[model samples]
Target: MPELYSMQFLLFLAAVLICYYAAEKLFPRFQWVILLCASLFFYTWAGLPYVVFLLAVSAACYRASHIFAEPGVSAENKKRVMVGVLLLHFLILGLFKYTGLFRRWSGWVIPLGLSYYTFQSVSYLLDTYNGKQEAAGSFWKYLLFLSWFPQLLQGPINRFGAMAPQFFRSRKFDSRLFRKGLMRYGYGVLKKYAVANMLAATVSHIFTQVDGDISGCVVVFGILVYSFQQYTDFSGGIDMVMGVSELFGIEMSENFRQPYFAVSLADFWRRWHISLGAWMKDYVFYPLALSKPMRKWTQHLRRKFGMQWSRSLPAGAANIAVFFLVGLWHGADLHFLVWGLFNGLVIAVSDCMAPLYRKVNLPKKGAGIRLFRTLRTFIIVNIGWYFDAITDVRDSFICLRNTFTRFRASAFAGDILIYQIPYRRENYMIAAVALLIVFVVSLLQERGVDVREGLLKKPAVLRLCLYLFCALLVLMAFPFAAEAGGFMYANF
Candidate 1:
């Protein structure tokens, strides 16, 4: 299969653009036919076998949607239909996806984007059942929505209602939008090839030394670099995906913000994977938090301990439950479960301690305090990364121990040399420079600056010079691995 950044995929994207616009000009009303064909082809390019699963999921969801929309359907029947379809969906997903425990025995090739599409289909069903929107009228259009190529590998998990018009309607190509799309694609390339891949080499080298006599500074450096590697790779993939969707004038829910600047674990999650978090908020968190049992618990607490405890404790419990599922959503591994619980416990404790925080007065609104919180959250997040990036639970703790106890910063250079990590000063310089660029851009964005839009407002000569420089930097990361690697989130 072609990686997103591969030359073959680029050529494929170019051909799609040419054909898509030509189709729009000629058969405008049916331009979507070309898109549907392209999506089908792109998906099958991954593997022909994967198409069977995609078709099955699409068909099941399509049929279920119609059943749900039927007039005079009783409440009990609607619920049965929902539960039956969901059970089947979860069964299929679990068999293929949650096979980490039995991966040696299981030969299931879980379809790409199974979780994304399944969650999206569930959202559609729930929305229809709750009268959020009517069920989609056309099966082909619905299938297109589910199988749209850009987000098929990783996704923002779109809604049918928001996307129906974009999928089915006729539209003209906009040169401006296309240019912006290309620019966004360039940014993604710079992030992945230039920075993330470079960092990946060092991170891999450091983690592989966990069993060796690596020092605390080396482990700390490895985990910190891993954090940036993960963010850039995942967010860069999303950027490229969004850029491609822009060529077709389809907008998805934005997946990330500047998560590193987050002031708390809760705030970090809110910024990172914004769509999945939104999904949990709507489907899991709200439902659990507002459930009858929680309501009764709240009443009991209110009568015994008063208002503050009543409000915060239930929400904290809901947070822990939601994050437990979030961790399980990643995989069936013990490490992932522990990672989720760590986050859940932090958020739960913070929530439950809100009243005490209010009682302790300081310069809460000061810039220094804000920076402190951001750095503190960042450190906490990096600690969590040990569980996530390192697979073995014991190794994760060992790395944690080494991070604090075995403090020798001088071993960093020797470890880097011993690992033969990229073995080039120029490579390290290039990656460092690229990261500096990212930091400046992110800082501006944190202050509400639209860096891309600002660049667009510059004079033609200035914009040309900047674009050329950025493109050259990307080219320097050349001889990029052709196998479609670096997207860390694709596994999920």
Candidate 2:
């Protein structure tokens, strides 16, 4: 399979674009055919067998949704079909993605985008069942929605209602939109290859350090770098995917919003992986929160304790359940489970302490308060990255122990730290400069500035120079053979 960041994928994308636009001009009515074909080719090129799985999912979902919209189907039967379709979708997802948790072989290769597309399938069925939208006009259009190539691998998790119409609508070529797409694509390239790939070298080495060989400062610094690597890679991939969609005049959901600037754990999640959060809230959290069992439980709490515990307890319990499923969705591993629970616990504790925070009466508008909140959130988030960075669940505890007990200033010195990193001093300089650039851009964005639009207004030559500099930095930071790997979340 060709890596998405590789030159080969670029060549493939170029070919697809030429064919796509030409088809749009000559056979306008069949534009969707071109898109469906391109999407299938892209998926098949990655893994031929997975294409069958993709089709099966799309077919099942389309049929189930169609059944729901049938004129004479009884409401009870429609509900049964909805529930059955959801279970079948989830069962396939679990078989492929969670076999590691259930069996000993542990060598099954999960299908790409199974989690993403399955969620999309669930949404399609539920929306049809609830009358949010009619059943798709045709299976082909529904299939195209499930298999759109750009966001297929790692997603903003496109919605059927929002995206399906865009796929079939007639669009003329627009120079401004194309230019914006190019710029977004360039920015994603810089973030992925220049910043995240470079940081991965140091972060990987530090996490692999054995017991008695690590320092407190090293652990903290390593986890900090891991946090940066994760955000850059995931957000960068989304940028590229969304940029391609923009070129086609399709606007994908925004996935990241400068999460590190967020003031609390809940706020951090809202900013990070916004689509997944939205999905869980709509499909998992809200439904569970309002379900009969949960309502009954809340009422019981109110009777046993009081209104205070009643309100917070039920919501907190629902949050724990949502995040546990969230973690399991990432992978059926103990580390991921712990990562999910850790986040849920933090959010629950914050809820319980909300009254105390209100009583403190901290100034809400001051820079000092904002800075303190940002740092507090950042620290908490970095601590959670330990579980994510370590695949062996037991190693996480040892890593945390070293982070607190083995303090050493030497970890900051050139010889000690640089020796552990796979990259050279010069590469570190490149990463540092790239990070500074991203930090400045993120700061402007946090304040509601459109950095891309600002760049569009700059002199042509200045913009060209900046683009060239970023491309060069990415080239310089390209990983060696031993360090090469795909995006972190590709496993999901």
Candidate 3:
């Protein structure tokens, strides 16, 4: 797949934008058709054979939802249709996601974006069946929703209700929106190429080092870099994707919300991958929490414990189940499973502790308190990255063990650490500066400041200089393998 930030893909996107706007102006009623065509073309480029699969899934969903939408459809029939649709989605997901987990299917490659699109399909089907949304009136509009090029591969996985109308409606060009989108796009490119990719050179080298060869400090340093690398790459990809969506006058949901600033594991999840978390809460957690067995469990807990403890029980269990699925969604591997459960358990504990937190009346507003909480959450999140970064389950634990036992502050001093890595001192300096920029922006965002809008208000020369700097970073890193490999989440 062509990297979204690459020159080739940008050229393709430019052509699509020009044609899309032309279609809107010249053939107003059929602008949706242009988007549909563009989306399919983009998907075909990404995975040609899978375009048929996408169409099949979209067609099935379109037909099923429409059938369910017909007046006088029995509730039982609607439920069955919903179940069958969900089963089909899970079946495809299982085939691709778990194919390599077993020895019999080691040769299979998971289709690109199967997890993302499948979830999207499931959400749309559920919405239609439950009457929360009407089925798309046209197959083309629905197809465009499923395969929209900007977010087709890695998504802020959209909903039919949120996006379909935008495709059907005509939108005039807005220069201000266009500039904001471009600025956001540039910021994403800067994060991906300049920061994330730069760190990748050192991170990959450190991660692959033999356990015996690296000290605790080295392991800790590697874990920290891995955290930043992940944030930049995954969130950066969303930034670019959302920016593209914005250019088309379609607002995609925000996926990240200064996740690093979260005060607790649950808050961290709320801020990170915000869309996926919302999906799971809406579809998985709510349903599971309200299930008969879970309700009974909650009542039993209420009898044993107090109301506060009992109320969170069902949701806590649902959270665990959701995280397990979240882990499996990432990959069919033991490490991911453990990673998922670890997050679920942490969040559940937090849920159970909510009452105590209120009783203690911890300071909620002071900077000192906020800083402590943020750092605590950051450390907890870094610990979880060990499971995510290490593909081999056993090796991940060993590395974790070594981090505490063999740590040496001297690892940061000289040739033993920084000098031995592939990245030079200058690269590290650049990364530091980039991270500083990210931190400042995140801090501003956390305080409800609009950094982009603020930048736009500055003098024209200042804005031009900043844009040029971002562009330079992107141009310098574009062709470098270490700086611009395919996005990390794109693997899913």
Flag the better candidate by lDDT, 2 or 3.
2
Estimate, for each residue in 136-217, the C-alpha lDDT of model 3 and write its tens digit. Answer: 8888888888888877667887888888777788877888888889878877877877778878866777666545645777
For candidate 1, write residues 1-492 as lDDT tens digits.
688878899999989888988987798888888888999999888778878867877788778777878888887898898888778778777877876554457554667788888888888878877778787777777778888888877788888887888887787888877878877877887888777877777777767667746678878878888998888888888888988898888887788889999999999999999989999999899999999999999999999999988988898899889989999999888999999999998988888888888899867798999999999999999999999988889889988887788868876777656666753666656677778888998999999998877878889999899778878777776654222364777745
User: How high is each candidate's TM-score?
Assistant: 0.95, 0.95, 0.94
Off by over 4 Å in 2: 100-108, 411-419, 479-482
Residue 252 Cα positional deviation in candidate 2, in Å, after optimal superposition:
1.2
For residues 203-234, write the lDDT of model 2, one tens digit per residue. 77776764665677777778888888898889
State the weakest 10-residue window (summed lDDT) of model 1: 477-486
In candidate 1, residue 37 scores what lDDT?
A: 90
| Model 1 root-mean-square deviation | 2.1
Give the Cα-based TM-score of candidate 3 against the true structure.
Answer: 0.94
Error of 3 at 462 (Å): 1.0
Q: Where does model 3 exceed 4 Å of error? A: 101-108, 210-213, 413-420, 478-484
For model 2 the local lDDT of residue 136 reads 90
